[model samples]
Target: MLWLYLHFPHLLLDHIRRTREETGALVIVEGSGQKVIQACPEARDQGVHGGMRLKTAISLVPELGTVRADQQQEARILEDQARWLYRYAAHIVLVPPDGLMAEIGSLQRLYGGLPAAWQTVEQALDERQLIAWPGLGHTPLAARLIARAGKGECTDDKGHIQRTLGQMPLLAAEFDARTCTRLQRLGLNTLGEVFALPAAELARRLSPETLARVQKIQGTRPDPQAPWQPPHHFRQQADFVQEIEQSQGLLFPLQRILAELEEDLCWRQQETDSLLLVLQHRHEEPSRLRIRTSGPEHRAEAFLNLVRLRFEQHPLRAPVMSLQLSVKRFLGREADTGQDLLGESQDLNEAWHTLMSRLQARLGDQALQQLSPQADHRPERAWTASGVQRNNRPAATMNDQLPRRPLWLLQGPQPLTEAPTAWFAGPERISGGWWDGQRVHRDYYIAQLHNGQLAWVFRDVRDGWFVHGWFG
Candidate 1:
């Protein structure tokens, strides 16, 4: 099976630089913050290079920016890239700290050919603003070595792969310092010279571990790689080298992250109504913002707009150092039955949801309410106003022959000081609330008042008449 290995020389540096608008000198230092592990092109142009002492690097470029390396953060960034690559290949093995190996042999037919698959991955990397050296080989180890040596190619020829593997220096063979020194002392400089020696002689000269590594690279021994699967829920974080003092400064990074969420939801063929956004501060406690929609939505622009409204309503309490976005629950996407085949029809429900979401974000979650019909015979108890429902449920069926109710209703019955000038149609008896102890027995009618105003009048069993509501 053909394998594709990707080596990111400066994964951390690239990730940090992608969010910056300025092309300035930047370097990623070790945990101790004493030396540089990776440098960007701008830093290199300023005579800054990897392995340089941090003090010396800063001396060379006074404005040089440094971000300390984090094992957990690096792992998260690598996993994020792997999740993107998973779209092109199913079997992917993450070589932590800087590499990814994918088995693309089985995908040749699905992608049309090897070259097309190679180009697809390349384009995906470009779109994500990442840099990777990719290599193709018959074995995972072989592809990894070539990629690490900056000699990756797109060819799938077995002979060419072997020849490329043979030309690699012994240091690129992934051997320890002692083994490389021993091979050098034994007049072995390149992997090709070591391969020319007999297996027995090589085994006699090298330890069993080194010999096994050699056989693995040569494809004589099986190198089984455990496939990596993406997580079910989407959680991504964006860390900054410089503290962002303004809330507006966070949008640049949030745009890209929300777009990825859109893609993930689209891939799952689902939607989400809730998102949790956390803002880490320099001195203050982290702020947690829960942004919710009126209904299940998958559009990035819609989510971003809601977030913007939230930001306007609630300002940042402190300088943000990093931000994390997470979606814990997912909802199934329902088909848009309101539209036609040509998509010319406008979805009124979608528009209503958009408006409600905006108002909720600007005001508070508890500020808005939705009116729902209740199963009650009394007019006042027939409907209820409560929080908006996220999932759409089938509306209760109603008889078309039933008399219509007025939109405007009074708080309660009022004394009718004047008699009705005319009567429309009524005598619709609604008697219930017997179990609730608030029994009501009245005959309602639609009548016009003497002041030329339409009103709803009702009379009780004692013949006492009153105006209960009005007809708009």
Candidate 2:
């Protein structure tokens, strides 16, 4: 079986640095803050290196920034990476503190070849702004060792893998200190020298556990790994090294998260209509913002635009230390919107929904209302304002057989002093409201008055002719 290993040499340091907008010499120190464990390129250029005392490194570069390493945080970050890798490979093994191993033997055919599979992972890492060393091997242990030793290369040839594995020094084999020391004493400096010894002889020289490790690395023993699975819901966050007081400052990190979300949605072939954004603060309660779309949405630009509009409406009340975006609800994949011969959407439903979403974002949710026809027969109560609902079908048109109605209806019917000069359409009787206390009995007509104004006049059976509404 072929395996791909991803070794993150500076996972913690990279994770911490991505939050800042400025570049500077930075290092992640040990928990005790005595020595540097990881340093960025800027720090390395300034003569800062891992294993150097923190004070000495600071003396070399006075402005060097340091963040203490946290094992829990590192583990969380590793799991986050695993979540991302799961989309490409189904069988992923999470190696604590720095590495990941995935069995890509089954994926090679699906992804075309080893190069394409490797490129896919590399592209994901690059987009995530992660620094990873990828290595390929016949076994997981071999892959991890090669990646950690910085000798990673894309190759499925077992001969090449064995040759690369043999060249690695015994120190890079991940053997225990006592075994390594004993092997060094025995004049075995490289993995090839150790493997040259007979298995029986090596078993006699080393403990059963260490012997098994060598066997696994050599693909003689099984080293099965449990695959990592993603959770049902997506919750991603970005922590800032510097607190941002303005809402605009949150957009950059938010954009990164939204892009990842768009990729995830595409992978799942699903969409979402709601998103929850939580802005963490240092001393105040987190500000919560709920972003809703007029319809199921998957595009990152659309989400970002709506978020920009939301920020404009509701300014930040507190300085944000970090931002968390989550989506728990997932909608089924929408049907493909048919395109015309030129490849543009033939239906205007999507465009209308987009317009409504933009309007909702700019104005309050309640600001926009849709007029829907009611079942009432009374002219005044024929239609009512209702919440907008996005649908593929166009609004129902008025039937030609139905009586003509005015576009502008008066608040109340007024008595007409003079009769109509001419009648365009007439004698449409309406009688309803028996269930309710207010009953109506009238004969409505479309007529033009003496002044040549078309009016919707009705003759109330109990009263006289009254002008009810006007036509545009």
Report the C-alpha lDDT of model 2 over 1-472, residue by residue, as the tens digit.
8999999999988886786778998999999999999999999998999999999999999998888888987887898898889999999999998999899999989999989999999998998889999999888999999999999888888888888999999989989999999999998899988877888888887887878988999999998887787888777777776678888888988888898899889989999988999999989999989898888888899999999999999999988877989999999976785974455573575677788888888897899898876778898788888768854465467666555578888889999889889998878999988889788999998999999899999999887899999997
Question: Model 1 over residues 346-430: C-alpha lDDT tens digits?
Answer: 4766787898999999999889887876778898888888987644444557657445887787888887888899999899898
- Provide the clashing-pair count of each candidate structure: 0, 0
* Candidate 1 deviant stretches above 4 angstroms: 336-346, 373-384, 390-472
Residue pairs clashing in model 2 are: none
> What's model 1's lDDT at 100?
95
- Please name the candidate that would achieve the greatest TM-score relative to the true structure: 1
Looking at model 2, residue 35 earns an lDDT score of 96
Models 1 onward score TM values of: 0.83, 0.76
lDDT of 1 at 284: 85
